[model samples]
Target: MTKFISICALVTSILLLTSGRPVKTYSELYRPQFHFSPEKNWMNDPDGLVYYEGEYHLFYQYNPKGNEWGYMHWGHAVSTDLVHWKNLPIAIYPDNNSTDKVKCTAWSGSAIVDKNNVTGLQEGSYKTLLAFYTSRGCGQRLAYSNDKGRTWKKYAGNPIIPEAPGEETRDPKVFWYKPGNHWVMVLYRMPGGDKAKEGISIYSSTDLAHWTFESHITGYYECPDLFTLPLDGDSAKMKWALLGGDGSYMLGDFDGKHFTPESGKKVLDYGQNFYAAQTWSNAPDGKRIQIAWMRESKYPGMPFTGQMSFPTELSLKSTPDGPRIFRTPVSEISSLYGKKMDKTDKNIIPGLKNYNLLKGIHNECVRITGVFDVKSSNMFGITVRKSRKEAGTEISYDVKKQLLTCIGSQMPLAPVNNKIKLDILVDRASIEIFANNGEKVITDNFTPAEQADDMELWTHGGELMVDSLEVHEIKSIWRE
Candidate 1:
């Protein structure tokens, strides 16, 4: 029934895109040069992230009709390097003729490769690529592709787990539980009615169509994801991490049926705009790469509304605070390195001293790595994309408060051995800062003046030591 409705919705969207007003390309006013965004539309909450057969598949919530959010559909894209993305057609759309009559939209979900033909949806000799997503008013639904995700067919028995009473559930993240030889799903559920319990619910399935409720984890919200990370890169001591839309994560133990918490909630990114993050399932060489929708801001005058954060590799480490997650840009980012500039072992003093180290850097797109000894300065940092003294973005460390400040947002960070390491990636409209080697990260969107193409280092009220500083111009992913 739901499959028939989706077919109708898909046909309608195709006709609309083909016959609608001609698509226009906005000027580079605030367009991102490297971040993943649609050619022209609104996008949010990256969905159904999976990697198979040498290609990384990305599906996201898209509003194809306008810039602002409206009728939702799954916008598709494929990438080989995670940096260069090629946009595909809309993958999943709302079922306009849904029997429930709620005017449903396709929401967030996950994808997997059924290598064993467990679902029996495979065609020819290829493993079926199955996508499990939430269809509003219809609950969880399944779609499968046999040709490496190039095309899809809605499952005949969709809404595999139909809408249950008192459960406002969505965002189904499914993974193969090797120990049990079955699939496990982590779904975000907020109980409806008077009893409001919001968290992730566990479900187990054998054939990918029939599901059985296993357990519930409390205190998390929408877009839940669960994965295991080897602590300190020790594969023998792996721990499971469960996180939600807000980037709050919990370390735990999962024995196929239930998850027992080992540590309480910890933040994944101390940023302003990272949300609805999803990791690529079945990545080559067992890499745990993740990406998130860069939300909380609007791209003024651009045809696109949102962007995606640079792909990050996730790991778990033991810190003084406890076991925490660390995220760094994937190694593939090094392929974008261009002109190099370095300033090592220099002491910077106060009183308006000017340094020409970054005089030739590309302010809009660059990667900067700096190590600073801040014992002598009250505030020390670097500013980028500065057209004037008051413009551009500032990434600073307040030695007095032991805080790392990006723009106006601040997160607590005590210096390690009286020194701080910062890795900053600057794009046309956004800045991503990884401090202390990804132990703390901040991502924010900013708009610099059109003429702002300068970078500078500054200090306040004292002197500081530059242990090492390296800046590299970043090439545009679109151009390559």
Candidate 2:
């Protein structure tokens, strides 16, 4: 009995001492919508690629010390389902502290599992997991993880790809084109004097070591990745797609040498805040699940925070207009919903003469959905904040012009504009203004300090008919 008690006490002491301070995780504070944190500190661009061995390992550009995005360690956290994540330890930190070595950040990259060393033609799987990422100051580098991805070791004399002129070239993604029977690498590259569009470099690697530069995929920017999905829900009509910097998409075809998109138009995102996208073919299920760096641009440093839309499930759905990109929140977030609010006339527009009846939020995530058929004017949305005339934020999307706008502290992390009407979600420290459902969106970060609670609805010259509305308060550690 004495020995058992002593061991238990020692274990307790070790846990208490090792655990340190409970990480003040603001991930749950963002909103009932989508919580993001590839594990604390500061996470920017999401990277690394496999969904192998059951767990979905999502890595990102994280700084373990502070909230400001720096240091550039790849923070890793796995999800059984994509939502409801638990923050894990720092996966990859900058070990090379020398001047000759590329120091600063690990930038962005992709991970591929070379199990049979198919690229080696038969080199075996001693180091099956391969990571191709951009090194700060250098060009692109490679690293391999053998025992799953728990720990990683850099390749000897790396920099598989040398520096190009505009060093802006970054984000490497490798995909196997089965028909061609070769591995292809897609990376970001910008022409020397061209500030307009960034291009995707295509490299062919037969032995995974010796890579030959082929061609450019699309004119894009920032982190660019490419994949092919069914165009009309049929493999016969497949289009090569690239996820780019400005929350856009490139849809076309890759014929061994180059990427030829049907048009230069970006396929469109689920909303405003999502960008620097990377996608991989789903492992077991084969459903293409694409995750991106949902940037909360303005409110970079606040105790409470915000994030991108949930990891999206992408598909090409045929619409009356064309083969439109259809996306919905990954199934994981659905687990966060308890009891859903029923649609009712009370949820209607011009709601009972605007009496600020605060009952429940519209959607599951403390959201508010309202439809106003405005004859004229910018009075299409509302300001749900702590007050009516204070520094509180207002979220509105002009239906006429087709743009969503957010103003104030607890706004969504997206682009703000005054163009369209929307189903806006007033998250804890964020707002997800879904314009025309998922067709358009604008997420922006706001910094309202004192009055983070309460709600208000303001209109412009004309009146807004409340089509429907809801607000969901998720069970979170940082509830307003």
Candidate 3:
């Protein structure tokens, strides 16, 4: 019997050796090097972003079944530095065991740390992490987590805010309104058809379980977020900003119950891809950091369906366009910078190619900063991710037209003193351009050949002076 068992084990080992190393899946070819994406499946609209105990928790709309949108669940990930992420289990999901499965999927909402056990859901010494979400067939529901969000329990008296007839409401963004001494919720509501009114409905709650509708602000669409920013970095001059899902915002003043607009509709991003933007709750140092879903960008044959824009630090600035929002990449991104190259004060004539400007730079991932004196040239800018034959994306400024054209998308620019400054971040498949110190931002995705690693600077029609240009190779966040 012992000899027969030994022979069977030997045969199983031989078959395992012949099966060829467990078929490695999850390709990295077109995957983002820094952006957070699930290992496989669909993700969109960053939801429930909160900071707690030195960690940033990000919960996003996820379809765990496939690469397409369906059966929404809250996919979880945590980051200490916002550059590297550690994915956790699905934080919330539909109750599949229930007899009625269709009404069980969990939808978008916000999370808060119940430090004072306000909801009375605390178990033992763990501080309750309460999440408010929209459940199908139910308007709004409350869930609590005591094990640091590893598990969750839906409130027994759910559908806390019952669904109203003739109203299609979802996407509730809740926050702690300290002055009001209660929790505030900014919910999106669309009332029925043709004559339907679409806008934000404000509600207030005290214990994170019960809610009372306070007021409603119309003239906007879905995914409402309300926050305040200090104008020109002055706390005394602070103003409130109410944002919609489509990147349109209104400057206003919030008295914890109603929002009074000081300005009309204005756009935050003029790009095609940004959508469903959300800001982190309880950010450290009173920072207003935001991120948006980069929609409809081609990911080719990859397993994921969408990507998140680089996290940006938002500030209200007094520009010629009045109190406009300014966005810059988060400071934590600088930790990925590597070897650098600099070119200063060079005369670039028409039809001149500055090969040495990118002489030893052969990286697809880089951060390039350029300051150009646009006095002499009709058109001048840099081309990046080029092949040997110079096939790449061009970023140019037209002095005569007063425009900045990036791959055919033209943006009217009123340069201050005829000097244009650009900060471009190049990832494997996307480029984020910040012009005039984040006054204008354009994000676009491109597909380049595998060998397209060259770069060049060119001028058209006349001469131009390159005040300064610096390029720094960026390391992949996954390398750590």
Candidate 4:
């Protein structure tokens, strides 16, 4: 009997060795250096972002089986400083065991700390943390955590708001409305024939369970977010901003139940790859910090598929074009800076190639800031991820057109005081550009060939002046 047991164990070990699953190293080619990405499989749409107990929790839409989009789950991670992240177990999973076998997948939503015990579910010293998410095809649901988000349980009274009549609704963004001393939920409801009615439906809740329909804001689509920001940093003057799934926004006023628009619609980001941005519910010091999923980025021959953009602080500033929102990278990003380089007052003549301004600078992960004197050039810009065998990607400015172009996408950016400032963060597979103090931004993704990690500055039609330039190589957050 002992010999037979040993033979069976050997057979099982050999079968496992022959299986085709390989261990992940987190150092695969094109893996993000500083951005947040899953250890394996797929991730998208940052969900359930809230701050509690000195920890920032980030829950996201995830697929656990493969690097493609199916079998949705709520993946979890936490960070103390927002620069370093630790992945936790799956927070919520699909309800596949139901008798109907509807395969209800957990979709995007928000999380908040029930500090006041409004739900009356607090079982221990820790206040209940409520997670409101959509059970795709089944309507919205509620989940609760009492042990500081380490574990969660779906409420027995799920499908809190059952499927609406003839409309597909999802992505619930819930927040506390202090003016009315209640909670507000902004939900996305798809249009059914009458496009005018296809918008966000606002509802108020007093106990995080029972909801009362309030009003609907038309013309806004999925993943709606409504927040109040002080115009120009003046607490006395506050305005509400409503954002859509595609990063388009409008400034308005929210009077508890309804939002009144005060400005025309505006694009928050002119990036093809940025989508479903969500801000933290309880950020410190009343600051609005946001993160987005860099969508549609291809990571060929790797174990992971998606990444989140670097966290940015959102502020409302008075611009020539009414009250516009500006996004600047959080101060914690400096924690990754290393190996600095600087240059100033450099002349870049037209038709120049391999200019000495960028000599000996070759890195895939770095933060670059440059203030350029437009001078007389018809075009001036920077090229990155370049090598002898590739033209790489170009981030150029067209002087006459007053436009900034990155990769294949473009945004109209007027020069501020006849000068343009660009803050560029380049990783192995993505580029995020903040032009003119975040007045206009562009983000894109591309897979660079091996050894394609050099940079160059070029001009066309005339001379341009580099008032100042600084480059800092960024260290990987996974290096510990």
Top of the candidates by lDDT: 4
lDDT of 2 by residue, 35-109 (tens): 564333566788785776766777888766667666777777776677655556666655355332236368788
TM-score for each predicted model, relative to the true structure: 0.92, 0.76, 0.90, 0.93
> Which residue runs does candidate 4 get wrong by more than 4 Å?
1-24, 96-102, 191-196, 351-354
Candidate 1: list runs displaced more than 4 Å: 1-27, 96-102
- Per-residue lDDT tens digits for candidate 1, residues 286-310, read 8899999999768767778899999
Better of 1 and 3 by TM-score: 1
Better of 1 and 4 by TM-score: 4
Error in Å for residue 327 of model 2: 2.8
Error in Å for residue 237 of model 3: 0.9
Which residue pairs collide, candidate 4?
Answer: none
Predictions ranked by lDDT, top down?
4, 1, 3, 2
For candidate 2, give the lDDT of residue 369: 54
Per-residue lDDT of candidate 3, residues 1-480 (tens digit): 999999999999999898775323333566777766778888888888888878888899888888887688899988898888888999987653433434667777888888899878899787888888887656788888888777888888887898887667888899988889999999888766323478899999987778999998878777788999999999999999999988899998899999999999887876667788899887999999888887775777777777788899999999977898888999998898899999899877765454346655788888899888876788887788888775888877888988877754567777777788889988777778888888888876666667688887888887777889999888877765
| Model 4 poorest ten-residue lDDT run | 94-103
lDDT against the true structure, per candidate, is 0.86, 0.60, 0.82, 0.89
Better of 2 and 4 by TM-score: 4
